[model samples]
Target chain A: MRAFVLATAAAAIALGAATTPAQAGATLDAVKARGEVVCGVNTSLYGFSYPDDKGVWRGLDVDTCRAVAAALFGNAQKARFVPLSAQARFTALQSGEIDMLPRNTTWTLTRDTANGLNFAPTTYYDGQGFLVAKKLGVKSAKELSGATVCVQTGTTTELNLADYFRANKLDLKPVTIEKYEEVTAAYLAGRCDALTSDISQLASIRANDTPNPADHVILPEVISKEPLAPAVRHGDDQWYDIVVWSIFATMQGEEFGLTSANVDQALNSSDPNIKRFLGVTPGLGAALGVDEKWAYNIIKQVGNYGEIFDRNVGKDSKLQMARGLNAEWTKGGLMYSPPFR
Target chain B: MPTVRWYNNRRVRGVLYQIIVLGGVVALAAYLVDNTLHNLERRSIATGFDFLGREAGFGISETLIDYSPADTYFHALLVGLFNTLKVSIIGIVLATVLGTIAGIARLSRNWLVAQFATFYVETLRNIPVLLQLFFWYALITEALPVPREALNPLPGVFLSARGMRFPEPVWGATHVAMLVALIVGIVAAVILARWARRRQERTGQIFPTGASATALILGLPAIAYIAGGAPTALDMPELRGFNFTGGVVVTPEFAALLIGLVLYTGTFIAEIVRGGILAVSHGQTEAGLALGLSRGLVTRLIVLPQALRVIIPPLTSQYLNLTKNSSLAVAIGFPDLVSVANTAINQTGQAVEGVAIIMAVYLTISLSISAFMNWYNQRIALKGGR
Candidate 1:
């Protein structure tokens, strides 16, 4: 009996230990060796990461993944996507199941510090907002005192929903579903009075998920700051730098007046900053341990940040979201990149 | 050494083998722990149970206890555990009653009844429970109207996609006194039952224990109600802004999960009941009938007591399965243990600790159930042909 107990204790200890090594440059090395970048993304958020009718991933987050692949392998098609739930995203990144998470995840303080994640610059500056049916005669969030709200579990929105209700001293019943589709479905079915998520997500849901987009109104109140960004695991500075620059390359592409159509023309420009950023000069790529034309490949294949945004979620897309806070820094928005030098 | 070699000795060899196996297990466990610690340190992810003390800034749709966003993670987990227990306990009772009735009906002389029971068992048990949950959830949320246009089938009740809301009595001092009196009445009835049993054994005259016990239990609570001045104040649920407020609510999520669990687990239990009844020899029924007993009396006295021996052990497993399957509440947003823990894991980034808590809770619940069932099984077991 004593021997049996000892054996069981040892077995329990062994079973409890979960291990994943996150050495520097390990992710970049893995992505290069496999000739593809595996990105964890939303299962189906309309303009963030959702599969088109052709089963091809098409969204801003998906474009970010392709940009990474273009930077590393110089082929946008070399990027693969793993659809993850909000609950599963961070764990997937931490366990090295994906190279990085470009899912519509907010860059929160806890996630950055305690969750061992490194956030790139905000890809889309969003805010937590509410979407309610117009028939309810509710004009504002403050009128939703006794309302039941539908929210997605394991996202920053859930926390913010709770905080908003508590701060306002309102009685709230939040139906938090794990699946984004289910959360919206619950709201459309009238299981809840309103659905709460990021404003961009709410717009996507209103456009694509609802039966009548005109029936549901996105409330004017932005409850919390939700700077949705891409994330990579800690302990890999080189891999982190590569991911950071890949994202910046797209923004810098836009700043330099480069597009997929005219990027080749800009390659011949005499401007030193644009030349260094487009990898006309070799120092930028060597510093990040990629090919000299890394940024050029991202621009040629995935387009600049503005083009990716416009075609996916802005005027050219079904969502028709305006570039409010997501415009370039010179346009008085949060989208800015440091000098390439 | 020639007379008795340790290697040749059976007990010594057995002890040595066990030691070697234990040592290997311990060594493996140590290596894993060391590796895990080293990697965790490198990643800078916080470990340990301290996160349980932190505020859980999430909302649960249903809660049995007082909880808010200000509550700790531990409090949030308690609410989840209660929800799990509430569904499982109710599901077990309802499934047992339904299964036993169906099992008996399957053996009935009526062909229609037998066929229906057979169809139910064959159909429901074959399908997976998770899919059934989704089906029921979709049906409830899609078929029901919104709260503004709730289907009002009763005076103080409303049915909608949100849930079913009905009036409840205003809990007050009088209600508390009534509850206490009800408990006292139950104890008095039990004592009366014991007395009646002893009297029946002493003199072969049967007392009407059932009728008299029922009278005592109901009569005492009635007396307390009357003496407490009959405060008939009721908290009627009225449509207030978004939903029906000031009443007892049965959320659609809970209803769908319960219905799915009961229907799915009931089929397995019905089979167990049927098997238990069949295990009792036909000769026992014949003997009871030969002794001038009615069929119902024979079943109640002779067959059921013996059948219980066969019924209980498997029933225990079904109960455990029902409890564990309640964790599937996450699929339909029922906020059961796994759902709450999944959120905790995401928020705190403590996957290991969150998972450990869930495992510990389920293990404790499963073991407690097994222990109680074992005791009940032992009680019903035939004792040396006494």
Candidate 2:
């Protein structure tokens, strides 16, 4: 009996040691060899990661995932979309379940450091806000003392609510529901006085509201800064830089007026910065351990940041959210690319 | 010599089989643990339970105990466990009463009553619990008007998108005395029931035990109320500006979760009750009737005893199932143990410890329920028969 137990223990220990670190830091290398990127995305947030009628996933976040795939494989469709929830997203990334997460996740200090994950450039600058019925006659969140607020569980919104209420010295009661759908339901049912979430989410919710959406008003309270960015598991600086540069490449392309529709026309341009950005000139991609044509592939196959955003969330989409803080640096928004030179 | 050899061989084989099974289980467990550790390490992720002591920088929506973002993961877990228990206990109590009424209605001679009971069971049972939770939380609740435009159900009650707000009584000495009387009345009813049973056995006579017990319970509380200062005023909910000024409010999350759980679990309980009642033989009722017993007597004295034997076991399982299903509150963000742990895990990156704590709590709750049911089943079980 003792010998049998010993033998089993030995076998288990051996197997554990063999497979643990075998695939750890080699995820980026493996992706390059396979010529495809696996990007995790939100399963069901409108304008972020929802699917169209034809079952093709398209959204602002999904476009970022596609851009990364285009940069790596020269074909945007080569990326596999892995859907994840707020609870399952981090673990999936750490376990190598997906290569990158473009799931509108906030870049918190804990997630960036303690969680062994690194976030790329901020894609969207957002803040927490509340949506309430206009019939309540409340113009600002400060007037919502002792009112019940519905918030989704397991998100930054929960803490942000606490901070906002505490800072305002308001004694607000929070009615926590679990899913994004539940928060919407409770708010719509008049079971909660207000629904709190990101300002962008408020826009989407208001757009999808039944009856006349004009009956509801989003309060002017942008509490807690939410800088959402794509994240990769830590330990691979090469993978980190690849995703960061991919995002910057899109912004840089937009700055140079190179759209997916105009990329082919502008390919023979004489401007040094445009040529360097399109990889007509070498060295930039090689510096990031990728080919020189990486930026050109991203713009040609996936379009630039503005095109992706306008298609998914701006005036053309169901969520007609205007570009506020998400606009380019020169255009008075926070989005700025590091010098492409 | 052959008989002795057979005995020795049987013992040896039993020992060898036990060893092999034990060894296999240990080996499998060890392999999994090792693989998990290796994977975590290679990914540069720390694998340990030390994260439980770390601060959880997230707040929960509805918590029974005091919790803040500054609290440790351990405290957050406690709050989650408390919420789970709170919802389950209320759900169990409400489901039992609702199920009992519906079950009896299904057996009623009235066609409308029976059909209504049947419709309820079929409709609720067919739909998934998570979907039902969403329906209650979102669609039903969100349709209500804002607080300023809330429809007043009564002078002291307001119904709005925020939730139902009603009056809360400010308790005094008289209230405490009345509460004590209610407790005493329940004790007296139990004693009277035992006395009535003894009297029935001693003489060939019966008393209206049910009526007598009900009167004892209600009458005593009434007497106490009068003696303990009868005019108790209600502190009604008053609408001020845009919201209610003073009232005890039940948050929408609690209301939605409670309603969803009870509605979903009550259907199963109703079916269980129906099955239990049907399992009792019709002959038992006929025999009671033949003995000059009334219809109510036939059911209460003859059929119910047998039906209870079949009912208790399944009913216990349903209660346990409802308790476990309460964890699904995560779907609608109910701040239950599972949801709280999920937040803690994400904020702290303590997946290993968070999941372990959640599993342990649920397993403990399951075992406790099973143990209680086993004890109850033994007490009611028929003795010494095949």
Candidate 3:
């Protein structure tokens, strides 16, 4: 009798999975019905996505996933993290194992267009660079040729290292490993002459991982453009729009100088854009199939872009990356959000 | 309608059972295929072998073949496959020889040898392979001197954090003659063995076949060496700028992986061999010794031939296990199949195809090994049991 019941249940699940087609609005309804968003993130990337000492997930990437949940359920903690490595991240997202992947993944043309995914707005701008021991006295990449470099095996950094060397016509030896921790271990153990990864990662590792932070210096050459962003599976436009606007709302918040602490003050502002953003008018939230306070909940539960950055990766954190290319358009930087009004 | 008999009804029920089982299998296969196709279509993810030809755009740390970052995904995977084979093949031979010795030692008369063998098997088999790999990797990489101050372990060998460098053989014209001499010596030894066996059967007198064969092989090679002017020289590695550039350097990754695999597999192989040897009857050994044979002859002539029949099947599984376990090479950064496939999947976003290729390669290797083992097992199985 138990065997009969198990067979029936298995069949039901198999049938349900088989018919999960691209039916325009399926994911949005599923997220609403489930009452939580399943978020995939990096297992251990400093500043972008990593667990704090208390085992709380916290990062710029973590906040992006949380903001999506905040917009949906008015609670940031509604999103649960499934830690993933670079090799497994895409499949985890594409296979519907997770509702979204907000890991520190660089948005490239092949990933954005060729892969079965749509990338949200850039959360953090990054570029490929090298980190070397300060004792080597190598000021720039040009001085280092035929060097043995260490990199995580499955990351874009591994591929980028190949490209950088091939483009420069330098003979480089790469010591690639499976996990980020192993790469760090190998680099520290002096198995390779240097370590290469995203510039942001170089900063995080140099600043936090090393015993003497001053002993290692990140090289000045930025080899490749790596615009890291959150990505969702394609074919769910409504869900995609929600994630995009949720990310944009954080950027919008930063542009408006409305932080998590002062969001209530902005709620009563007479400025038309602030009123619209705070959902004094409810159409934008309704269009994305959420509560009128979607953007408001995002800022309230998770902080806006600047607050999230400062709390995790930027000025207040160990990474301490200046928002250079990440600064707003009005400040003569590249970040520009679509108007809310 | 005519009433079916009870026995006839049993046949009906049996047919129904077979139909149901077959139906279930077909349904499961169809469901999986349908779901995969649906998922791939929904995501617009490409499905095919088109990506294999594209530039892998990645570098492998250790390559047995001439590989560069410009190679295709297929080439990278091939390199990975070869690397895995290289480690597994060498590890298997080393494990078998070590295991056999350890297994025999476990049953040795000397208490120290017995205890040592037991200690090695018990301690090593209990610890995880990954941890062992990490321990070995860390032990070498951490303890070795830095590149600038590499330790000269020998006149030609340099040990450093980067790797261990040894002298490389520079072959000359005489190498071809040496190869020819080896082949000729082997053929001569085989013919001599057949002739001696025939002569021994007729005269009831055993020739010193083993000693004669060894002399024919090694002595002929020595003669060829002298005749060909011994045109082989060693290119001793020396520190140039940062590292020893011109020699055979064993990377720390490869060494750690190889040692970890050999020791770990050896423990299991030792247990299997011990079990096989114990499966042999004590009466068979006593009978050979009672016929005025030495204990060595009793083991070699009576016990081992039987024990091997029992050992080969389990030993085959051990070899397969070793090959599959080599995928753990990724954990320590040895470029094996799984690691290279992982990079391919990440770079190309062809997880399904990449995974399929990995499975196929491992399957082929396992199937081939099993086939050879089965042929060998058939050759050794008792033709007519007593």
Calculate DockQ per candidate and list them: 0.49, 0.44, 0.53
* Candidate no. 3 TM-score: 0.94
What's the lDDT for residue A19 in model 1? 39
Give the Cα error of residue B199 in candidate 1, in Å: 2.7
All candidates' TM-scores?
0.95, 0.89, 0.94
- How much is B242 displaced in model 3, in angstroms? 4.4
Rank list by lDDT: 1, 3, 2
Better of 1 and 2 by TM-score: 1
lDDT of 2 by residue, B1-386 (tens): 44655425777768776876777677777777777776666555666777778777565666778887678888888999999999999999999999988998998999999999999999999999988877886754556677777888677888876668889887677778778888888999999889988998999578888898899888887898788778667778887755676668775667778899899889988988899899998888888899999998898877877888898888988899899989888876677899888877776776877788889999999889889888988887778865
Question: Which scores higher on lDDT, 2 or 3?
Answer: 3
User: Candidate 2: which docking quality band?
Assistant: acceptable
User: In model 3, which runs have C-alpha deviations exceeding 4 angstroms?
Assistant: A1-24, B1-20, B240-242
- The window of 10 residues in a row where model 2 chain A has the poorest summed lDDT is A15-24
